[model samples]
Target: MPERASARRSSRSFAAFDWLSVLVAVLQPDGSVQYANAALEQMLGVSRRTLVGSDFSQYFTDPSLIQSAVAGTHSHDFAAVRFEAVLRRLHQDGIPVHVNLGVGELREHLVVELWPLEQQVRQDREERLLEQSQAHKELIRNLAHEIKNPLGGIRGAAQLLELELQSPELAEYTDVIVHEADRLQTLVDRLLAPHRHPHEVGDVNIHEVCERVRSLVLVEHPLGLKVLRDYDTSIPEFRGDRAQLIQAVLNIVQNAAQALAPRMAQGDACITLRTRVARQVTFGRQRYKLALELHVIDNGPGVPDAILDRIFYPLVSGREGGSGLGLTLAQTFVQQHHGLVECESVPGRTDFRILLPLP
Candidate 1:
């Protein structure tokens, strides 16, 4: 083929495949990458110039697997091959992915597609979590209603008994009952707050929300703790409840600040509020072209593994004396805005990501 014609053909091919959502790469018979699409470059966290001409096997944890898969593409025994393998990336941990390998008869080159299993699993998990959250909200609302009436009766009876008591010492016992009943009522009110309150929707600037939370966190931890802002100035205001969004962000930042108590004592506590615009986000089974991504990241000892999964559940607190309703309320508020909140934690790092659709 002529050099200029071949160059045009290659550019056209890459342009045609660049818009694909899945990772794709054209490989030579020897398993060297000839061309990588945009999605593949983003997935590998590298540029096309760097990814192209590299050995395809270097990207996978098990090089022999890709080699065999590429070899199978050339074999007459199989028309196409699919297998699971761990993809290794520079300066990052390996990601388990499913690969589809096939040989293209037109170009006489091997084409490979990569799909991260973790991403699929994460999506499935998010769907389930949304469903579970709905169910939990319903249950909590009903349970709160059931307990509310009885709680009122208990508190009234305790007050009546206190008035009837002959001795002050005996009256103290009824006082204790009254106080406990009041506490229970408060707890029930909190459990039912999201359902009872009307959502007040208005234009919401995510940076304003972060700023409010930052101010509140700093007020609580004035010394030794540093709160940093990493805002994407290009993100425009969206429709949401400003107060609710502020509360949601505040709850997350408060939890992160509390988690950083140990680090604060060591004078190294740091929390970051990062905002970005994410494209092509799917939340609650609805796809949005643009969405707001706000991250509340902290450097702490991390959430305990045992309670990490249930951290957003009501009454499931990892800290002593914690009501455990912060994240629950945060999740509820974000859900009301048709958004999603997700958490990822390790020993030294914890990140809470809130995704909200933008108009």
Candidate 2:
């Protein structure tokens, strides 16, 4: 009866593993697969029944890596081991993945978890971006405060000087000072805009936001640019600030439009507004079952490599006469809605992806 109970418990646990997003497998001490979860089966493109008796190393291009990982776990060198390798699927090309091999307390079998290397790198990048964004916000706030006080005094002094001026030529000097001060004040106000307003939350349809941005982009670049929409209309509305979301998307699309000027002259400029639902996404160190993915993709000369990593930072513009606040504001607005904006650019393709968690 005890043996039957143990078997039943094992079956129940294995059944529950099917629902996990991460691929998992149970391996015997000799490296034979004892059990493979649904995610693992799907990843390997082979059923669990066929995988149970096979060597786990057979699924990887470098079998020795898996063998070493399993050996280390069995020898008690470590409770868990992790490494990067390429996974081979039946009749398919090898896929790069990160593997975590571990031995549970029972020590009956080794547990392995696999994550796509691209996804792992993306997750790490997002975490770093989040940290950098936080730091940037703090710095902007402090700088704005420091500049705000002296700015008023300077503007007031410029006005007083203008009033006391006798010659029109002298008046021009004070006029320059006042005008420059006012310009700086306007810039400071823009820098504070994201923090100044309270988010007005409502049910936001992402397609509507995209459409609004599309219309604006077309109006600005009425001649040569083609703004295309590839939306997954089935996505449900989530709660967010509609106006802010529209502005966020508009900034990215507008930037893309600006970048496409060269291609536009050649009659080949294209910007695609693509939207889809992403499942099992991780953002800001938390995992979500569903998230909205919005992409502003453009075919143009890509962002310069020097400023690519710092593109989201304020005052880091790749274009001449750009205020450099567009991407920063977009990122701030998205983060307000518990989302993130990421960019990947090559010579002819630049993709700006915004990920917002869904309800």
The candidate that achieves the highest lDDT relative to the unseen native structure = 2
In model 1, how large is the Cα lDDT of residue 196?
81
lDDT for model 1, please: 0.83
Computed on alpha carbons, the lDDT of every model, listed in order, comes to: 0.83, 0.86
Residue 225, candidate 2: alpha-carbon lDDT: 90
Q: List model 1 lDDT by residue over 237-327, tens digit each.
A: 9888999999899999999998889889999999999989986455677656688899999999899999988888888899999998889
> Which residue pairs does candidate 2 place in steric collision?
none
Tell me the TM-score of each prediction against the true structure: 0.75, 0.86
Candidate 2 lDDT, 1-359, residue by residue in tens: 99767755765666666666567787778988877877677667788778977998988878998898888888888777776777777844554445543344235778887876666677788889999999999999899989998989998998998888889999998889889989989889989999999989999999988988899889988888999989999999999999999999999999999999998898889999999998655687776778999999999999999999999999999999999999999999999998999999999999999999998
**Candidate 2 error regions (>4 Å):** 1-23, 28-55, 64-84, 91-107, 115-117
Q: Which residue pairs of candidate 1 clash?
A: none
Q: After superposition, how far is residue 349 of candidate 1 from its true place, in Å?
A: 1.5
Error of 1 at 155 (Å): 0.5
